[model samples]
Target chain A: MAFEFEYSAKNPLYPVSYLKLRAMHSRLEIIWTGQAENQAQGLAQRVEQEMLAMEREFNRFSEKSPLAVLNLKAAMEDVSVGEDLFMALELSEAFRRGTRGYFDIATSTSCGKDMVSYTLNPKSHSVRFNAPEVTLDLGGFAKGFALERVSRMLSDEGVERALLNFGSSSISALGTHPYGEWWAVGVDHTKQHGIVAKEVRLKDSAMSVSGRNYKGEYHIVNPHTGASVAAEELILVEGRSALVCEVLSTALYAAPKTEREAIVSQYDGYRASEILCGDCGSVSIRKIG
Target chain B: MNRKEFLSDCGKIGFAGVTLSLFPWLQSCSDKAKQEVKGEKARIGIIGTGSRGCFHIKHLVQMPNVEVVALCDNYRPHLEDAAQYYPKAKLYDDYRHLLEQRDVEGVIIATPLYLHAPMTLDALSAGKRVFCEKSMGYTLDECLEVYNKRKETNGVLFIGQQRLFDPKYIKAMSMIHEGKIGDVVGVRNYWYRNNNWRRDVPSPELERHINWRLYSEYSRGLMTELACHQLQNGSWALGMLPEQVMGSGHLVHWLKEDKRDVYDCVSAIFTYPNGVNMTFESIISNKHFGMGEQILGTNGTIDLVTGMYYSDEPAPKGSGMHQLIAQIESGVMSNSVFAGTSWAAESSPLAPGVPIMTNVKVVTGESTVGAEADGSRELLEAFIHATITGRQPEKVLEESYYATQFALLADKAMHENQILRLDEKYKIPYTPLK
Candidate 1:
């Protein structure tokens, strides 16, 4: 449950800098390499601003957050939404359909079978909840969404080498490490302290790791069943899209074993791996395409 | 990050990494020792029950592989306070009495700077493993004597050079040695505190006994007490010792009211074999800077205390993908596995440096006695493992010996105001512990 979120460059010779902040119920970190100090500071401030904007828009726990306001008003009538919120809803809906409802943002317990919990009005830029009990939560989706945006921001800023990580779960890497071919990261064991479950090498890609935390409490819920899934294995998904990786990791972990490959097959250039700790004191890694 | 991940990260340097380099002795500091012991406990005895001694006791009680068999202190209150942690352990007023016990397999000497050499020598001679606190000795002669005694007794001796066991230092040192920060330029070390460096005395006669650090006879003041730890940074990063040392000391602040003869402000500069200078300065008047040890290189700087690296060069103006493409076209790219992502416009150029290792608790060195996440606990754990396995951690004694000499020599350089080299008599051949 206590994960080690460490990022290192191989034999790095250039000056690498990073920015750390608390956002969206997680610690958000951005590391920029081979950049001048002033440029890195400017770029880091921009990235921080981007993530903060998204966090303010997506955070439902805050009373003044846009999501909370929408959740409260949309049930009774169509509520106007901003571009960021609207985009997040559209992405969530797409992933929900892509994962066959396994990645639902709207709690399914409040909706009828085979029914969409909320309707998005593109023309009016508004959302209306179909059911009175419908509540929208982006706790699992915001990190990925923010990482994807930050990734694009770094790409846009002409930053060649960088790493962005959110709460040790959502991660994005641009270019290779200054010294090595890839940015190396370790997935910590879910049950054992300090034990590395998997070592993932990433370059120009993103990865999401999902599992029960230190207390053996599952954070990912099965959107279809409306209950936390009890998975013994840690699920890791890596791909070019940070958003896709985050959605798939959560969906695959919540879904049953038989349906994981099918769900992953829906996405291109993505790979999922199930890390299991065996009684024989060895880690068993099964790769899925 | 935990022990394994930290050690594993430090394992990968471009050249000879910290784990695989000169300090081969750190093998015992890893978690492998816990596995080797197989739940067996190492019987440990404490010679002093001051703040640092209790600090060790705090770590000892938590360790499942260590048992506090004996506790000794001349002060009854201190002994009683420490006994509360492990009431089962026998208590003694005198350390010699504690050393006589057959059950005490190893002893942790945290009495004072002056007592380190004598207690360590006695513990080793008594057929017990010794974990002596730094500086290794009160004087250069004592340091040499203790070094020779370890060989004479063929005993397992662990010095309090905790940086060698710290994960942040290991990671930073690895990066430094790997040319991450470019060629080593210079080393800057400073410790600033605002306290009077005094402890409450129960009676009038116990002033020197309670406040040992403020006296020349009992301690080397700030040099041995503080600078010894930071002095190791230059040698560890450059892989060589200083050739000469010169400095000045003054009783700047806490002067008239106290009988303390030790200087409150001291500055020493050590010139290495490569002609690079390592500077040390401690002032008790201000606590603004706190404490910091930095290794300055041509390309960048590494703050060993805070574990951050700052670069001297300016950042490039374009995207990494674009830079990679340019490098590829120019045939200057060293990274073979390059996949181009989207390239874009340039941003403003200014940024704060990154931490060498993330998730580590960075101590600001405010606590005069002990600080958390400062490698003290791990150092004690390594010593306990050494005692249980009967294997001496190689090069630890040499490092501690030289660090002690630096402190003592710096003191001499300050008092005499002349540059002093290590006496040929004190130089000992480096040997790996078998």
Candidate 2:
């Protein structure tokens, strides 16, 4: 929880008001650009409220939280979940298969200890654990899920020019910056201070950056080996879908280097860039198909 | 992190009202506490207006709800120079006269090491809050006396341990306490400087008064003057005290012809209760590796001075794709992952160290005077808040006490040329490493 990602607005010359809030144990910032100042302010407040609501609903820390309740009760019997929770689980299941079980929430429930087996019933909007150890921790999926909802909220509210950044990792942009074709977001150099290893331009798209370095050792564990990934590279996935990019970024980062290209290829229109840095801050970026 | 974002993080990271039990002293730093101390001016007096005093004055003059009501010093020039910042303040040649002023509710003592204990005791007895510069005292007994007096008087006391109030340190310590770097194995601290550390005196009679840091009677050499701050790192990161200490000191660089008995170089190794060794080495001859405190752990190492962490586990190298990219960058065409099935698995132990905290200005420990954003201003602000509220910060005196004790013991060990064990009487009730 002490880990934080840095956020920098590439085009500072553009006119936009930033709405900042704390959610999901990290900083969430929304840069809103609109003709009416009052409208934008109102939208910022609504977005903050919605994000806090989602945080409360999905937070595993609170025993009474929806996610916590399901994690606690679903092991014994089929526990019905909310529509949002069900959708998140279904999407996580699809990602699990797509990433060849590399991106799994259940294995991380107890820090990769004990095998995880769970089944999701879409028709009943419920989940049942086949194994007693099959607890679900949605930490890897929550940010992306929340970003998708924020994207929907902005679209329904007729907001076209907005940027949603959750924890500086899960990001979704509704439109381009006022001055440029797309909003320019720089990827922080894994080792060097004040250095941007890569700059990603996003226009009506989403980007997700995942790495085990920022959060300390063994922060991200591989489900296959139940051990932390020792790779120092940062995996950045940018695509049209925030959810897909988020899942792919984490999956590709945790998967073996050989399977990365195949895992990324499973998702359409999504590209993953592996940022490799030498000892002296020399960065090499490898793109996966 | 900026102030706004930092406070937002404090709220979100359970430092707000939710779970301040971890860092109870930080309760005053919360946004809620910020609102509580609003619109309350704290009248303060400066006891010693030298360079360090002037540094505090610079921050004091800029602080809201803080008024410099008095200035005092035996040296007229320093006092007069500091008076320029607060012309309305009453000037006195003696600190006792300044303490007598009813309006001055608190006193900041940035005097010589020998004077810290007596001045703090006097300020406390005068029913005034006290903020004393560190090396709590010239001797361990004095430190204990001053510490016990504060308890008896129930007066507010703040030491010049700025790292406690620094954002990066706070964040790093939070991670450390949460086992981010894993079990702490060793603590390595060193301060290297190239200068003789002598200040220019305007008059021959003022030589001893101006450069008190080089004298044995007025100072405890590098241990008290410099090592005091570094000695506290081990206890803080581990929440346990060193069991014994042994070391050696000698004038390896600056000779005795400079008219100083204090050693120009010294090295000490402190054995903690857990058998972990915390080492301190300082020399005035070289500036390489300027100054740093590294908390070595099983999994990683935290460079507190630079706010960086180097994990022990090396990063596994990328596939042949990285070679392809490097070749393309170097303007060489090569058949890469698309054409090659043969690859080598490689790992590099020299991975680029990740920064523990960003956006905050980290100090390199080169300043003789205080450095900016080094928690000096924030510590002063916290003192002002304490003086206004009439409440003491939690665990501050305990930490200052242990640091002073460590330094004093190290000095004694070096002087005796034998390993010294901590006396049982000095131990206090405190938390231990889990």
What does DockQ give for each predicted structure? 0.01, 0.01
- Lowest lDDT block of 10, candidate 2 chain A: A1-10
TM-score for chain A, candidates 1 onward in order: 0.92, 0.89
lDDT of 2 at B82: 96
TM-score of each: 0.56, 0.59
Per-residue C-alpha lDDT of model 1 across residues B167-219, encoded as one tens digit per residue: 78877877787788998989999999999999999998989999999999899
DockQ of 1: 0.01
Q: Which ten residues in a row have the lowest lDDT in candidate 1 chain B?
A: B338-347
- The most accurate candidate by TM-score is 2
| Model 1 Cα lDDT, one tens digit per residue, A1-289 | 1112222233245555667666775666666666666777777777767777887899888899989998889889999999989998999989988898888888534786457888999999999998888888997788888888888888887878877767667778998766568876667554443456677788999989887754456667888787899888878898998888888988999898989989999998899999887653578999876
Taking every candidate in turn, the Cα RMSD to the unseen true structure, in Å, is 18.7, 17.5
As a TM-score, model 1 comes out at 0.56
Candidate number with greatest lDDT: 1
